[model samples]
Target: MPKFTGYVSDHTKFIEELKSKTPGMEERQQEGRSLLWDKLPISLDEEARTRESRLRQNAYPYQNKF
Candidate 1:
């Protein structure tokens, strides 16, 4: 059997230490999510109208230069 080094043991110990240090971490994460990431979905009709529906591309993109 191959003996693994202290990396895995050290990582587990670090995680336990962090959990003990931070209380209510999950609740805080949820509160942050509600404040920042919670949003209503908007229609994409305006986007579709503003952009070209057809795909466009140059055959050789590298040849073009300003």
Candidate 2:
């Protein structure tokens, strides 16, 4: 198992700490897709082709849709 940083052992204690340290944190959540279309490198086309080949090599049958 992997452990995440800044996590507490107890849930209640974690919530209390979070509330005191970062008030109104829930109001700042991201609501929709923020485009990164301009940030992609020119080599992205080549990288994507490589990724598609790799995925095709390890393709598995679709078992469910939800």
Candidate 3:
């Protein structure tokens, strides 16, 4: 088996080209991602309270019994 060295895939090339064309693009992407995805650590009490407050759905929710 031969390993292909110094070979850039099309996807990698596209990303590199995009980054080169747009200055601070990576930083903006990071900021956007952090805004949506980055989160502070949740305390155990908060997590337990959140879990305990959830309402359970009845089985066979479509059918109602009076």
Candidate 4:
């Protein structure tokens, strides 16, 4: 298996910690879902949507790359 780094590794560890901390199945499932949303590349459409949303929200300064 390939090793994850940076934010991916951090979030993976966070989800594991969350699972260890939570006892209920539903709670773990919810936490897993949240982590999946943050980390997984479920689809290109989802990826594009996330990038577009972040750009619109001005999470980073806009720059023209032309």
In candidate 2, which residue pairs clash? none
lDDT of 3 by residue, 1-66 (tens): 989988989999999999999999989999999999999989999999999999999888999798
* lDDT (10s digit) by residue, model 1, range 1-66: 977784577789988888789998878889999899897765698667657676777888779667
Better of 2 and 4 by TM-score: 4
lDDT of 1 at 12: 91
Which candidate's lDDT is highest? 3
Instruction: State which candidate, 3 or 4, has the greater lDDT.
Output: 3
Q: Best-fitting candidate, measured by TM-score?
A: 3
Query: What is candidate 1's CA lDDT for residue 1?
Result: 100
Provide TM-scores for the models.
0.37, 0.27, 0.74, 0.28
lDDT on C-alpha atoms for all candidate structures: 0.80, 0.64, 0.95, 0.73
The C-alpha stretches of model 1 lying farther than 4 A from their native spots are 1-12, 43-66
Write one digit per residue (lDDT tens) for candidate 2, span 1-66: 977878666987988799789966655433222342335465988988888888443254665545
Clashing residue pairs in candidate 4 (N, C-alpha, C atoms within 3 angstroms): none
Model 2 score (lDDT): 0.64
RMSD in angstroms between candidate 3 and the native structure over all alpha carbons: 2.4
Q: How high is the lDDT of residue 34 in model 4?
A: 94
Clashing pairs in 3: none
